[model samples]
Target chain A: MTALINLVYLISVSLFIVGLQRLSSPKTASSGNLIAGLGMGLGVLIALFAPMESGDDNYLIIIGALVLGSGIGLVVAVKVLMTKMPEMVSLFNGLGGACALLISIAELLNFHDSGTFGLAPYLTTLLALLIGSIAFTGSLVAYGKLSGNIKDSWKLPMANMINIILLLTLIAASIYQLQALDTMDLVYFIMILSLVYGITFVLNVGGADMPVIISILNALTGVSAALAGIIYDNMIMLMGGILVGSSGAILTILMCQAMNRSLLNVLAGGFGGGVSSAVQVGDQTVKEVNIMDASIILRYSTNVVFVPGYGMAVAQAQKICKELEDMLEELEVNVRYAIHPVAGRMPGHMNVLLAEADVDYSKLLDLEDANKFLNDTDLTIVVGANDVVNPSALDDPGSPIYGMPILEILKGKHVIVLKRGMSSGYSGIENPLFFHEKTSMLFGDAKKSLNSLLDELKTIV
Target chain B: MHLIIEILTDHLTILFALIMAIFLGFELISKVPTVLHTPLMSGSNAISGVVIIGAIILVRSSGSEDYISLFLGILAILLGTINVVGGHAVTNRMLQMFRKK
Candidate 1:
């Protein structure tokens, strides 16, 4: 029976691997998610048949929990808007972390009752507890930030100092527990401290940096689950956890690379605090373009590129933006979207938003491809994006976002920026592009602005 | 010292499994396109829900009188199910948008 279960575990692991492999591309991603879900279902069902010493029939509790959880999950999954994807992901990540943390705690209790003190089991349990606790609270904080429940202005003084001290204390306590094989009191103490650390660690990070924090927390949750797998000697758990852990790590690296910032730099907090008054916009006069003028410019253009940012998601302007794109296409103007990797709240946020608006995937160009297309484009329409297209990132070393990669939209023949007002971007950095020679500011709500522009284009065409 | 050595020897195969799984994870995910990053993340987030199995195992072995472990196990199972069900559902929903367009 054990051998048969192990064989099924092996097959389920293969399904997970194959599912992830299929998720790498656009065409198979949906089915890939289904395949992975199938693996999870099989693994959960087969776990019922696994050998256990206790004869207590707890199947009722298990089935009830599963049904209740599935009911809640299905409702939220169906009801959540695409704009809330990051928050939903963060919430689910937190649940996974909490699940792992609880499992480790339960196992530890069982081990204590059985008098099974050993270096291996205790070490894995401690690791899982620590990582799982952190991931849980950290993820919830991230969700709060993303959902606007936690304001960016909320800060704890000496945040970095506090984090370092808490971490050091956690390490010290963990060492003592391992050395002394301490009682449950010490374990509970460690868990509380870990949870506190999680909250403090993420509380100070500015809103713009939530993506990196989410990715890190996701990775931490995966690592904790993997540790739980080690404790239980379960191959499927081990494989799935490692896979998620690595994916999150890779994503963290990619996000950092997109912004040209290091992981440590992000974790240090204080990013996107507000505009750095030190770097002024100087004497460059701001250029303003009316809807009529902007429409005429776009209508006559041979090649036009749209740059989207988080504001597009906030104002729900993606559909209008897509409508503008279709209008331009009817005029025989070449239209494409330039998607900066870190453009929105999360990785690939703009792509998903645009895709939801029914924009063809092929019309979206990544950072590299978009830059190549921007070089010779007739005009660039920036919809609710600022920082990603800022020229200071390339030229002014004094700027806070100096070294980050930008769209270089100035390379095009003309530029039109649609925004709500003359404000700094999410990072609170002033954009020189707003005052540049070739740029024209079209100030309004992004969706309203796009709607007007679309109307004006109708008159022209 | 002898007990420590015994534990290490017993877990040697599991350790190897860990190392291989880590490598396989990195290799499989390294080539994913940026556009799919969101779905990939949510999908893999669901996979981490496999910890549900451990919760089940723990619950099954705990006696009914052991209220602490039973409560913890049930809660773990609940949260794990949410992660699995919601994560996959959300990822599929997002991917459906990408596929339809």
Candidate 2:
């Protein structure tokens, strides 16, 4: 019977791997999600057959929890706005972390009850509890930050010092617990401290670093889950957890590379928080263009590219952006969108927003392709984007965002910036791109500006 | 000492499984396009919901009189189910928008 169950688990693990592989592309992604969900269902079903104490009400409790959880999850999944996806993903990640934390606590209590004193069991249990607690609270804080409930700049004074001390204390606590397993209080103490550490660890990180932080928390949750599997000797959980853990780690590295920042730099916090050093533009004067002239340029341009940022998401202007793209296409203009990897709050955020607006994924060009296209493009419209297109990232070494890659919007024949004001970007770095000779600012709320621009284009054609 | 060694020996296969899974995990999504990063994130997040299995097992193995264990186990199941259900559903919703038009 055990061997048969293991066989089923093996098949489920295979499906998870295949599902993840399929998810690497857009065409198979949705079905791949379903396939992974199917694997989860099989794993859950088989777990029911595992040997257990004969409690008649256990099945009832399990069924009730599953139903309630599924109903809430389904409702939120269907109704959440695409603009709020980062927050939604953060919330879901928190719940997974919380689940792992609770599992560790429950398992630890069981071990205490049984008076089990093995080295491996206690070690795994402590690791799970520590990591699980951290992932749970760290994720919640991240969700709060993303949702605007918590300030992006909020952090404890001496945060790095505090974090190091907490980490050291946790290690000392773990060693003590290992040596003296007589009481459960030490376990509870470690849990509480770990939770506090999670909050401080994430609180120090700036808003722009959310993609890396979210990915790290996701990987932490996976590690905790694997630790839980280790405690219970569950092969399926171990397989699934390790897969998510490693993949999430890779994703975190990818996000860091996109910003040209090391993981250590991000975790040290305050990258995009304070005002950066003043880098004087050649001239303080920026050329401003009216809607009519901008429209005229768009009308006659043979090729144009749209660059979007978090501001686009903020103004809820993606649909308008898409509409403008379609109109340009009808006028025989070759329109494409240049998507910076870290453009929005999370990874691929701009892509998701544009996709939600019904823009074909094929119309979106990544960093390299977009830069290449920009060189030949007659006009480039930057919609509510700042830092990602800032030329300072290229030439200004003293700039906060110097090493980061940006869309070479200035390479185009003409540039129209749709912005609300002359304020610096999230990293608080001044953009010389605004003052460049070829650049023109069309100032207004992004959605309103785009609406007027569209109206102007309509009159021209 | 004997018990400790026994536990380590017993975990040898599980350790092997873990090491192999980690290597495979790194190799699996190494070359994903930037466009699919978000969905890839949420999808793997759903897979981590496999902890729901352990939660179920925890609940089953707990005696009826063990109220704390039962409560914690059931809560784990609830949260795990939400992660699995919500993560996958959201990822699918996002992926559905990526048409080739």
DockQ for all models: 0.77, 0.72
Q: Model 1: per-residue lDDT, tens digit, A279-318?
A: 5776667999998998899888999999998888889999
Candidate 1 Cα deviation (angstroms), residue B13: 1.1
**Candidate 2 runs further than 4 Å off:** A53-57, A272-278, A281-283, B1-8
TM-score, chain B, model 2, is 0.89
Model 2: lDDT of residue A240: 89
Candidate 2 lDDT score at position A271: 68
- CA shift of A405, model 2, Å: 1.7
lDDT, candidate 1, at A307: 94
Tens digit of per-residue lDDT, candidate 2, span A216-321 = 9989989988988998788888988999999889989999998898998899885645545558764589999999999999999999999998889999999999
Model 2 error, position A448 (Å): 0.5
CAPRI level of candidate 1: medium
Error of 1 at A116 (Å): 2.5
Candidate 1 structure, TM-score to reference? 0.97
Residue A18 lDDT (model 1): 88
